[model samples]
Target: MRKSTASPAKRINFKPSVAKVIRERVDGKCSVPRCKNAIRGPAAKGTGSINLGVASHIYSAALGGPRGQGGMDNAFIASAENGLWCCQIHGSAIDKNAGEGYPPEQLFAWKALAEARASKLITDTPSPLGWVDAIQLLRFPHATTLPRLELSRCTLVAGVTASGQTSLLDLAGAVTQSAYAQRFIQREPSTSRVPFVEGRLTYATVDALDRSVDVQVLGDDIHRILEGKPCLLPPGDIQVIYTTLNDLQARPHEDDVAFLLRLLGVDRSALKAIANAIDLRLAPGPLRFRDGVEEDDHGVSHPRRTPSGERYVEAFCEIRTDELPAEVTLNGLSTSQQRGVILALLIAKAQQISQERLTLLIVEDLIVNFDSSKFMQLLAVLGEMPFQVLVAVPPARHNELLEECAGVATLKPNPDLSSWRLRWLGAPIQDSSPSVRRSGVQGSRAPIAKLL
Candidate 1:
């Protein structure tokens, strides 16, 4: 005798609005945690939307459908409460094998999980611009270690060449880029020698959605870390501006200047402020900064040597007054004057962007060429901006810069020649040696013995 098969039960249709409500609850993402694919997109050629998702039923719509649980009343069968929004693939898979793979309990759990994620995303949207509260280092490259760094209005990172000051700042930027730091640690735990075994990075939200983002990185891969969640900074909400040695030229590259201005969102008011600051600083000097152009030309243009054998660009911005020539060339300016002009430009650029996003201005020894007074002026201007500032400088200027800063950290080479040790300068100091607790906790701790 042949095995008997039950005939297909009467098919129940879903109300038009029921599918919309179910999709809205899950933010139009597939309900399955591992397969949160976007199922709807703009129509191929028409104005109407196209939906590739299926509002699958946790309890089947028909008596013979997956997990249909025969003999239930038909009215409640196709209601919104029974729907699970998922991509067509997962939806079809669930309905096959008589729902053996995905039972009613499992499908309902996915629905709940998807709704929770959607709720968090909707409620926790970041403000237009938020401040960077702090940068916590759960892990870093090499042997030296650091504690949770509390940021302030201004921070001075003092270190000798190759002492890892720039590396720390780079790591901070990486972590802010969509959980890359977390993924790095998850892949290479042996590279980090820090106390926090479960690498975590926490940042606060300004609109008070949550106090911080507590990200656990260890013992889990990138996929597990996400677990159907989003990044803390979202996309393009935070900007990290890094001015390296290449950007600190006396006469900055035209392309670099234009890029900086665009990032800084410069305007006439900002240019005026920069000019005023430079003019005030250069008092008693013959030269005064009035205004500068966006660049020498519409796009990238090289400097030309004049008949007098002076390298000049076509007034790429200006540094002129009534007594001075109509056009000023960068080659004609003195070192101090050029430094002043560059610092002013940078400050003006930084101030303009702070209002639009959580901006971080990272300057690597840009003021190393400045005199004490000019350096102080640059620090003052940077501190006034609404963004966090990280300045990396050599140890010689540590005393000059630390007095006015909110916090300071020093990176010094170790005697053993293995790695650079990092020390936080909690207070202004007369002697750098006194601030480093060599014989304290750092001395007693051994190198990383194992990877978790």
Candidate 2:
């Protein structure tokens, strides 16, 4: 068992004031009254200084929306018009529910909401899809590929192909198409015809690479698209949604796509209730083993014995999409682990986050020195959260932490036990009368509702 740390996250209600992130994106408090428009530097922030502004979820907190987010469309970046320019204190307060919705008149409302916002109940209004901030971008580090719009049943959705082609408006440009063609037609333009595209949002294909990026515009046709499905999918099923944290973080290969899917538990749907978190590989170095052995790369014999036997954990730092450096330091862990953690949290609460209702998180193989018991306790406390938590083993060994989990699943070979698969639940074991006994335990009766 690795030495577990006593650190635990204080129970916090994920605030709805948290806005989405976009490239140089920021929600603008209208400098003009009733004009309902504004602008700012960017949605993403730099480490060196401060970008002072208020972040408002396009979907209000009162509307059962996720904290630190706006709406289904604006999940990745906050809009310039979606927020106001309040100082940090007010931003924090409103972020912490110390403020009320839709720009209130006084500070008193903020204080009350801070203290009572979690308890204060308000019904959400059916907002017309007019706000520019109400539009959803595909995902962070926006894709330059043409987007695919789905006009399904109720909501119109837009995103690029996994390979970055075919946009929503491109498919929906003709609203007067034949019904069969509208249902499942392949769009092919005739040699001499160019149909006029009408949409509240517009996108252009800039490149074929995963890093290919383009500017997006919001329009009324796009709004109508937003109000209706983009003919993206057939009727009657949940959708599994995914977005790249950073297209350049890794190769734009199917392996990367697979990882993203597994992380979200919806590798193939429009909606998922879980997501995989990332492990930061800020720099590259040798892989280490807990048993004083370096992986693949062998170490030289000491002329004199060193005091510390060996180091096992890889060194890392947390980062977001834009923060990744061109060169990395490690092999196994290779992206923005911090943002992966954040996205995982959001995934566990997708309905809330996507619809803007709640926030949740999970992290796998987080290498830490905290003791197993202490760590398990913290995980338990976190599991009680309104959202969800599913942390993986922090990439260590000895199975000390694994055995201490609230739930454990091991897949050892039935005959020889030569190979096995083990999973950890991150919480302390709950004492149940029907304790699991291994295959070798003499006279133990088999028990199963289904061993899954």
Candidate 3:
């Protein structure tokens, strides 16, 4: 009898286009969770590019290979759907020990997450709308028009209690028509003078031409002017979020943890990342549903109604943090600590929610209660964020705040009964005189800035 020879298993390889598509789908980043290393960049010579990514097979192309073929069709096994983009390191690591470390389910999850993140980046990245380079008061209280205050990426406005620190922040919010602007701005009772705030928004056009738009807010009216002409429609890409220290403080009848979770889009992973970034630990308790239903005498279920005859349902998870004792609620933390948590949560929410719009974050009283080191750490974080940050600090902390800020705007009440004097410090001024010198006073620091 002749010896029988068995046929070798067919091996299917990914086509070039299929591999390219797999890599492009994830924006050329590794499809490993928390290992999204950029795989392509300029080479050493600068004439060509270097690629450190691999289009790895989810299931091996041949039998007896890592993540064996498992009898999958040759066409499907070689398609882009079966491929995962990964850095060279992860590509090898995943296949070690016959792919025992990483299961197919885990790889699929990573691929889905990576693709979702890439899609979000494409959708959320907005066009550039420029920055607020200068602002001038139009008809604010106690002043008609002040000097055109120049703004930097990180501008510090420092003043005493009644010296217009909050007023300046309010003007910024009003100019941008932030959601909380109306509530924060003090309305003039007499209505004799309409308050107005105007700011210069400078941005580059598609042709690389430098252009500026003047955004004016007069009382209840808001408009944009370009090239000395009023634009019929204002640009809709700008977004502003304003929060005061008081806003960060816990409110009666409001659950801080629940509100924070909602603000973060109920994404516990994101909340955990934020907690880690802020040096805090988070342990979310089991979810609870309450006040949604009730049992009657007949054992029949019925919807629960409030005293006002409105049915309501509530579900929440108790978020425990290291800031307070395990037994104590979030309110048990100090006022400053509570404010810090709220501010950090807001920052995280802003980062997750909006990436395409021109965002301006106006914050008040951020430097209160934090020691110098902690305050500096917060400043460093703010500086690294992808946005313009404007902080309002007391005149006394100007020196410390100035170290991290691009420039400082000192608001001082005039010696006489006149308008406030705006002095620019740490920034070069054409005219350097004693009249524009800095001042000294102890107060709180608040951050007001923009983000991309």
Per-residue lDDT over 205-229 for candidate 2, one digit per residue giving the tens place of the 0 to 100 score:
1110011111222221111232234
Q: Rank by TM-score, highest first.
A: 3, 1, 2
Clashing pairs in 3: 126-356, 365-446, 366-445, 387-451, 388-450, 389-449, 390-448, 390-449, 392-446, 396-441
1-452: candidate 1 lDDT, tens digit per residue: 12224344677767879988898998888887557466888998979898899888887766777787445455566677778998999888888889998988777777775775566456432223444445544443342544455454466554333333443454454433423334244334443322222233233333222224333344333211222354644335456565444334434444333333443345545654554544334322322332333335568554544344444324233534667635444445565665555555555555566666566676654555677666655656665556667665444455533332223333323232122122342322122332212222122222121210
Measured on C-alpha atoms, candidate 1 has an lDDT of 0.51
TM-score of each: 0.41, 0.19, 0.45
Per-residue accuracy of model 3 over 340-402 as CA lDDT, tens digit each: 665666566555434665555655555555656555555555555555556555444445433
The global C-alpha lDDT for each of the candidates, from Candidate 1 onward, is 0.51, 0.28, 0.54
Between 1 and 3, whose TM-score is larger? 3
* Worst window of 10 by summed lDDT in candidate 2: 203-212
Q: Rank the candidates by lDDT, best first.
A: 3, 1, 2
**Which regions of candidate 3 fall more than 4 Å away from where they truly are?**
1-130, 159-164, 175-235, 249-253, 257-328, 399-452
